[model samples]
Target: MELTRLKKKLVTAVKGHKLLKDKRDELMRQFLDLVRENMALRQKVEAGILSANKNFVIAKAGMSEQILNTALMSPKQEVYLEAGKKNVMSVDIPVFETKTRTADANDVYSYGFAFTSGDLDGAVKSLADILPDMLRLAEVEKSCQLMASEIEKTRRRVNALEHVIIPETQQNIKYITMKLDENERSTQIRLMKVKDMMLEEAHHYKEKEVMVE
Candidate 1:
């Protein structure tokens, strides 16, 4: 009975190991995709920031510091961000949403267009255009981080199941089977001895009765 139970447990462990392995593989694939996306987004974000900075520098150089500061003093835009989560392979990954409210194109330039250099407008527009991409980059990067962590955890579980639980369960089953076999052999030997003694006793009784007759 113990041996049968142990075999059942071994089967369960093996099945569980397979499932964990599959999950790990899927997680790894997702992780790699997220990594590639992160790399590309990082590059694009870096380039956008650099270009915007260069434009800002040119605008600053072309205009007085006071005028530039005045132009940027009053903001006509507001941004709202919401964060949530989505499930992937039993792992929860964060989702980010961005909502932007701008007064109007007319109000984007706080100061007169004549007072501000075209470079400033270019810089502002470029930054504005990249805002959504920047948010996307942030979301992707964070998801990559989370997915990497989950993958590592899943790998550890898979390794443990493969190396430890399944092997140990199999070993237990083997041990129980060996013990049961030995017990069966011992019982057979005892039964054979009893049968031989019974036959000898019957033969002795028959000889005594014949001699009496």
Candidate 2:
């Protein structure tokens, strides 16, 4: 009975190992895709920031520090960031949403046009345009990290089932089966010896009865 139970457990372990392996493979594939996307988005965000900084530098060079600081002192635009979760392959990844307080495209310009240079406007626009991409990059980066962690966990489970549980169960079943076969052979040998003794006694009794007659 114990052997039968172990065999059943072995079957279950094998199936679970296969499933975990499949999950790990799928996670790896998606992880790699996310990694690529993350790299691309990082590059895009970096480039956009660099360009925006260059615009800001040009704008600063053109105007006095006091005027530029005064112009940017008050910002009309307000950004709302909403963070949420998305499930993918059993991993909960982050989802980020961005919304502006006002729909007006010009709301990004905090200062009046009369006071601000065109270069400042260009810089602000650049930063505003890259906001969504930056959020997307963040989301993808977080997803990649989560999927990588899940993949590692799945891999460990698969390895444990494949290398440890199934093999031990099979070995145990083999040992039990060998011992049962030995016991059955011993019982058969003992039964044959008893049958021979009974036959010999019956022959001896018949001889004694004939002699008395």
CA lDDT of each prediction against the hidden true structure: 0.86, 0.90
| Candidate 1 lDDT, 1-213, residue by residue in tens | 788888888888888889989998998889888888889888888888899999999999999999999999987777789999999998888888876676453345556787899999988877877777798888888888888888888888889888998888888888888888999999999999999999999999999999999
Please state every model's RMSD to the true fold in angstroms.
1.7, 1.8
Candidate 2 lDDT by residue in tens digits, 57-104: 999999999999998898889989999998888999999988899988
Let me know the TM-score candidate 1 reaches against the reference structure: 0.94
- Record all residue pairs in model 1 with backbone atoms less than 3 Å apart, i.e. clashing: none
lDDT of 2: 0.90
What would you estimate as the lDDT of candidate 1?
0.86
TM-score of each: 0.94, 0.91
Each prediction's number of clashing residue pairs: 0, 0
Off by over 4 Å in 2: 206-213
